[model samples]
Target: MNKFPNKIFDIVQEDLMAVEKELYSIIQSPVNLVNDISVHLVQAGGKRLRPALYLLCARGGNPDPSSELLPMAVAIELIHMATLVHDDVIDNADTRRGRPTANARWGNHSSVLTGDYLWAKAFSAIATGAKQNMLKILTDVISNMCEGEIIQLQEAFNAEQDEADYRLRVAQKTADFIAASCELGALTGGMDNRDVMQVREYGYAIGMAFQITDDILDITASAEQLGKPVGNDLRQGIVTLPAIYALKTSTHREELRRIIVNQNMSNDDVRRGLEILYETDAVEYSYTQVSKYLQHARNSLPITLNGPVREALLSIADFVGLRKY
Candidate 1:
């Protein structure tokens, strides 16, 4: 598998390989289709940032992570995969990670069931190897993720949705899972409560910034770079940070609002909206917000976090802030 040469990933290379092996082994099933779909998603390219964070946090506490750490990382990644499958179904998406989504390849019924299977497998692994507190944190993250999805659906096409609501939704949908990964890893690795909290806060900040950057990419990145349709969120009536900022500050707010509310906006309409967004510098504005969160993430790290692992964590934060994909 190809790995990014980012300093963070280099430091945790062996642990990440262990995570890959665990992910492959844990998803096996007697039923061929189940194994096929599960493996297919696993083989599909992803950064595996959450698992890396988990492993890195573990390393922060102990140079050689306990055997349980790998399984925990696998479970965290499985939870993430489960969500992506369900999200594709909800979005009626055709592709993800430059390949056909499970929902697109297998029918919604099968896809939904496969996602459930992943969730079951994830929880099963967690129950066997992780502490009760870690399980509770994972459970809460899942709940918050569901709530975030619901909020997005509820507020879809509502042009008046404010920044506060957007931030809350981002926190629940993306930040919580990232936070749990760090917290659980830190706890399992024998970090004190204070250090665990610090890492969790760091994860939350980066997670928020990550999602904001994703939203920005949906506007600015090409379809090839995004591995899915660009402007999809807008097409689905999901108002994002750029649109929100543009609506508040741009002279083209009325036009943007009209286009957004229109259920049948064409590609040209989305392009026009993009033009307005660029004119208002909404993308830059949103990027500024991302920078603030990145700074917060760095600030959340304890001073004792100063070795190579700490540097890796800090570099990961920088990558999240600046990554194009």
Candidate 2:
């Protein structure tokens, strides 16, 4: 019942609630620890944007829920959840969505295994009835995500990274899964091949914009809004779009370099770094890039695709552009 920025969610409120139930049902494990950790992660809460997008696409063909869509939706969400738990372990993050992370509460060992269990469960859900192609898509997404994380680890604090490097990383780390979600949704929705391609492109563009906006918010939004520490990426030496732009454009490039390379920046240093980023207008520059991708996302949608679902998709696109958290 929580208000979402995208009106489409409100329109599909009942279906999303169903997805929430399915998510819980699918992740139930016989192992008490696995069940406890997975349940805690689910309770932590996320927008469920990935599954929502899937359901929207599926509804286009099968307005009344199909057996195929629910399992796919559950699988997508579980994959996303697995990433979050593992990401927390990698970052040594203590909190997520304003709750203690699995790693934080259960220790890294348990958390890693819990994350693995989630991954296994995700694939199991998919294997139940999904097509071979769908399995291939999911496998490729997992590979890309791992490669993205490895690339990010390799590039940490490397201020020399360019837009291409960032884009590739974003595509692997975030956009591919979103693209897969839309593609699979369209496929399940009985959309034609061309239309499915269009939706997939739209998902990819929006996914890029989503991550760029998230990176911007990491520097601009408060910790409470983020449900994680502000400037956490910078603190961890994970240079994002704003930092990349600031490195290229800011007058304080040398200072930024020193702080970033040291990788042990103090709070005051982060404050000053943010100031430099602001002065350099890196945030606004990133926003411009987000706008470019948003434009692409809109253009990718077929003009012939009309009605509430189409409108909802457009609305979600706009929401991505304007979202703060």
Candidate 3:
């Protein structure tokens, strides 16, 4: 547990419990398997970052707890969870958060159907308020996320992935979710166009930073800390920022590429590949790159935001950079 400077960290547990209860209620279905699969993954839990973004964005305008806001939080969480379930299937990951993945436990067919079910459930929640503009935005964000994943698969281990390509992919796949969460928050809080755009920009920058840090951690963090296997991205053949950096800058780039490209590498081969990344300081270099985005995120906040809420958002940007794993 990182000691977060923001008070949101203090209240995060309580808010998550609330969100979880609400999520459970919304997931109720006539089909027991869909309900079971969704709830299992939901309760298995991870950082509820998207919902927190939604809540913070809502609080920025009006600190009051509203019915609409809770549903929006739930919607964001379901979308996030749905993504995770689908991602594990795509990655063929056996475990997540130290437990068998939904795809592993319930089979890929069930997990895929469950993910689709949650997506529908999330849209139904969004439709409760049914702002056509908001729906359009959410739809666009989801579409972009899918496209990002597709592009990532296409680019995997190409040895030619650039900063621009990586940034664009992460922005759509990762940042869009955060942006949607923040935008939805502002929308429910009655923000105008300027504030909404500001929050969206803030989310995009921070989300990019977050994913970059995740890439670094994949190389640097221990499996215990990561709650999944280390080098998970590399294992999937998806080269992230650090891997791309090492490919460009490391003296051992050819050897590393050989290990990955040849496929069927042993654990020792993966270890050496990781060691090459460390020798070249790719992890540290990746952190430096992420810091630039974190700063950009801080600068993106609306001038109107100040006080604890402002500080909380800033702390979130920092937290994204500083996560140990």
Candidate 4:
């Protein structure tokens, strides 16, 4: 198969410079320490997809893009980055986006502090200028995000977890920000409630697909490609979709059971469990499920959107599930 860096990748490359500058402009800080830590992570590079989603949704509503969209973009990214840094600490991960994780580079204390700072900045941006309704939406979104993460932690290694539970977890953890980002963008576009809700649903579907694909790739993608070992979720005692499906069909269900339920599995035991997962079609099955969501996302797009900007957002939903990075 051809690699993922093609036309859609080119679109992101073309827009990245403007997006980067916009992010830099709003994330400024008088506190040198906070600025230093926050800038380090920001500069490290992310796909900028969350912020881009905001911009794209704005463009879709009105053909003209706005500089006013900058702070919102920056705010969304700051919130996203903060969550990631905190997640690395929670996961005890060493790398992100193929670079050393903030937690790894700056120690847990700095990582946590920096993450908190980002959260504060993101909230401040929303409270200061954005519409009150948008701010309220974001506040609720962040709270839901925290709830999702906590739920994931609670369900970790609970192999009895079902697909519905998996979908709910991802909806709360990953889809909320995505949905909010699109809604904020549409609001910025000056769209009415109905249009905003439709776009938000589109974003939510994309986010759900994105997270499900992520879970599948955690089992199927290689370390060089993933920036960490496959099965990182399993290592952290989180049983993802593949594991859940695999265990159902696993001939060695008892072995898998002992490891997941009892806890404290050796690295070798986890490795063997992963092998069993691969041997089954669990990864393939999950990918099939993700594809269905992606299709739903595409179908959910409003017919009103018809141009390069809308196409770009659609391309992104198509890209995320299949991309190597």
TM-score of each: 0.96, 0.95, 0.93, 0.91
Tens-digit lDDT track of model 1 for 1-325: 1244556677678878888888889889999988888998999849898999998888888634345677788889999999999999999999887799998888888889999999998988777767777788889889899999999988888898989989999999999899888888777767888999999999999999999999999988888888899899999889999999999999989999998888788999988888888899899999999999999999999776778878988898888877886
RMSD of 4: 2.7
Best by TM-score: 1
Residue 54 displacement in candidate 2 (angstroms): 1.0
Per-candidate count of clashing residue pairs (backbone under 3 Å): 0, 0, 0, 0
Give the candidates in order of TM-score, highest first: 1, 2, 3, 4
What is the per-residue lDDT of model 2 for residues 1-325, given as tens digits with 9 covering 90 to 100? 1235646676567877887898789888788988899899888878888888888877755533546577788889999999999999999998877778899899999999988888888888878789888788889988999999999999987888888999999999999889999888888887888988998998999899999999999999888888888888888888999999999988889999887877778998888878888898899999999999999998998665678878888888888888888
Candidate 4 wrong stretches, greater than 4 Å: 1-16, 25-33, 63-67
lDDT of 1 at 145: 99
- Against the true structure, candidate 1 reaches a TM-score of 0.96
Cα-lDDT of candidate 2: 0.86
User: Which runs of model 3 end up more than 4 angstroms from their true locations?
Assistant: 1-6, 9-16, 63-67
Compute the lDDT of residue 204 as modeled in candidate 2.
Answer: 94
lDDT of 3 at 149: 92
- Model 3 lDDT per residue over 1-325, tens place: 2334446555345665688898989889888888788778877877788888888887788644544566678888888888889999998989887788998889999999889988998988777665788778788888889999999888876767777888889988998888888888787767778998999889988888888887887778888877788877777678788888888898999998886674576788778888888899787788898889899999999999777778788889878887786
Whole-model lDDT, model 1: 0.87
